[model samples]
Target: MILITGATGHIGAAVLDQLLKITDPGEVAGLVRDEAKAAHLKAQGVQLRVGDYRDPASLERAMQGVRKVLLVSGGADEDGLQQHYNVVDAAKKAGVACLAYTGRALQNPATLANELMVRHFQTEEYIRASGVPYILFRNILYMDTLPQFVGPQVFERGIQLPAGQGRVAFALRQEMGEAIANVLADSRCDNRIFTFTGAATYSFADVATALSELSARPVVYTPIEQPAFAARLHAQSLPEAVIQRISGFLTDIKNGQEATVSTDLADALGRTPASLQEGLPTIFKL
Candidate 1:
């Protein structure tokens, strides 16, 4: 049986849905912390196994009779690295034959100034040292995030960010989840690293242009310095941690760490990945 951690989350939930369509529901097990939240999945015939990445004993219990596992990275917290360590150690001890993890698409996340990327690098190292057969999916920024980053605000007040002319190869979350499901099912995918991204790339300027055309509203992109952007966020009463993360992300984008375009996603899913223009309507509810 295959066990997928964080199965109630967006990516994990989509992965489960795709897996069910391609394979028997009996062959899949979802690691859920709250049974109440997973009642829908249980009703769909997926076996619900209670497990928490912070709890080693619960992970071991969930890993019983499991041959393969997908370790979806933990949420946006400070304990992500330690939580990944706990899951990797338990999976190794359970003698899991194949292990897969979702990580950032940056070639060297540790070298970047971003805290989140550094944690991903640390988790990757820990998984390598665990001696378990593994595959790493380096995922790009989600197109879904565009709604939160630059959306209706652009139509009203215009868009502003620390990113310069830098571009991002954004992929839809659902497509990435489908690719993950395909990789986990194919034994040949073991021990390989894949980068999942859209077929095209776009910059903030390009996004503004697209919105202006689609919405028939004049949207403009204003490039601002990193410190000034942080100050603006602070004025809005955003937490310091959030301001730091957003600023660090803009720095990475400007450094070209997020502009990587790859064909691996199409190869895995046997089709072309959706572009930003194709996914914008759904993301912005247009």
Candidate 2:
């Protein structure tokens, strides 16, 4: 059976949805902390296993008889890395043939200068050292995040962030999920690294232009200083940790860290992933 961690989450659910469309439902399983919450998945003939990344025994139990496992990275808290280690160690001990992980599409981890990317790099290294066949899905920023990053009043407030002219090869999260699912089901993808990115890259300026055309509204992109952005977030009473993460991401984008485009997503789906113009409407609920 193929077990997916974080199965109820957006990416995990999307991966399961894509997998069920091509593979038999009986061959798939989803790990959830509460079986009650996963009743919808159970109704779809998916075997539900109760597990938590914090509990290694639960992960071991969840991996019983599972040949493949997808380790969806956890949250940004201090325990996140340890949670990832728990999953990987459990997967290795369970004798799983293949372990897949979703990480950032960073070219150089040693000098990424971002805390989140660095943590992802550490997790990837731990999985590699486990000696289990693994596939690393290096995912880029999601189009879905545009709404959250820019906020609900994009056309009204315009775009103001520290991204500068840095471009991001953002793909729809659902499409990334589909590509990850396809890779998990195919042995040819095992032990390989895939960068899931859009066929093209776009800067915030390009995004503003696209929005103007799509919604027929006067949208503009303006660069903001990192401290000012942090202050805005602080005035909203956001946590310092979250502020740091958001600031770090904007800095990464400013440095052109996420600008690279790759064809791996398209190749896995056997079709071109949605372009920015095509995806923005859905992202913005337009």
Candidate 3:
């Protein structure tokens, strides 16, 4: 049986959908914190196991009889590393045959988001040390995040953060999730780390142009200094810590650190991943 944690999340749900298409429903288990939140999945024939990363016993219970486990990272928190460690430890005790984890793409130890990367690296280390075969999917930035970053400005004033001409290889969350499912199903992917991205690279201006084409509105890209950008986000009611984190990420992009596209995703799925243009309509509902 395959146990998928974070089954209610964006990528997790997409992974579940893809798995259901190729595997028996009885062979798939969804480890969710809230059983009520997973009623739809339960009705769809997925075995529901109540679990949480903070609670190792819950993960242990959910992992029982599981052959494979997909450890989706917990969302924005300082304790993300600890939570992932708990899940990894539980999986170790469960003697799962294989494990899969989602990590960030191109996260260098010296970069601004290095702390997050370090946590993932640490988790990978633990999984490897536990003698369990594992696959680490280092995913690129999501095209869905573009909407979250650009939508408010478009609705209020039709502006976007012109982070210069730097390119970002962004992919649809569903595409990444599908790739994860493919990895989980493939027995040959043991002990591998795949960095996944879209089929093409795009600059921030390119994103603005696409948005303009989709919305039929003239969206303007406004480049600003990192500090100024952080101040703007702060003024928009974002918490100071969040503003800092986002600004740091934008800085990394502006410096062209996260631009490269890789073919690992295609290799894993045995098909080309989706491009930005192909994913635009789905993201913008155009």
Query: Which candidate should be chosen as best, given lDDT against the real structure?
Result: 2
Per-residue accuracy of model 2 over 1-286 as CA lDDT, tens digit each: 8999999999999999998998999999999999999999999988999999999999998899999999998887788999999999999999998999999897667656578778898999999999998999999999889987887888899999998998999899999999999988885535799999999999999999999999999999999998899999999999998898888888888888998789999999999999999999988877
Clashes of 3: 0
Measured by TM-score, the strongest candidate is 2
Per-residue lDDT of model 1, residues 1-286, tens digit only: 8888999999999899999988889999999999999999999999999999889999988998998899999877778789999999989888888888999887556558677788777888888888898999999988888877774467898889888988899899999999999888876635889999888888999888888877788989998898888888899999998888888888888778888989999998999998777888787767
TM-score of 2: 0.98
Give the Å shift of residue 130 in candidate 2.
0.6
What ranges in model 3 sit over 4 Å off? Answer: none
Model 2 off-target regions past 4 Å?
none
Superposed by TM-score, candidate 1 places the C-alpha of residue 215 at a distance from the truth, in angstroms, of 1.5
- Predict model 3's lDDT versus the native: 0.81
Clashes of each: 0, 0, 0
138-236: candidate 3 lDDT, tens digit per residue: 888888888766755573465446366767899888888888897787766468889998778888778777878777887766766766776677788
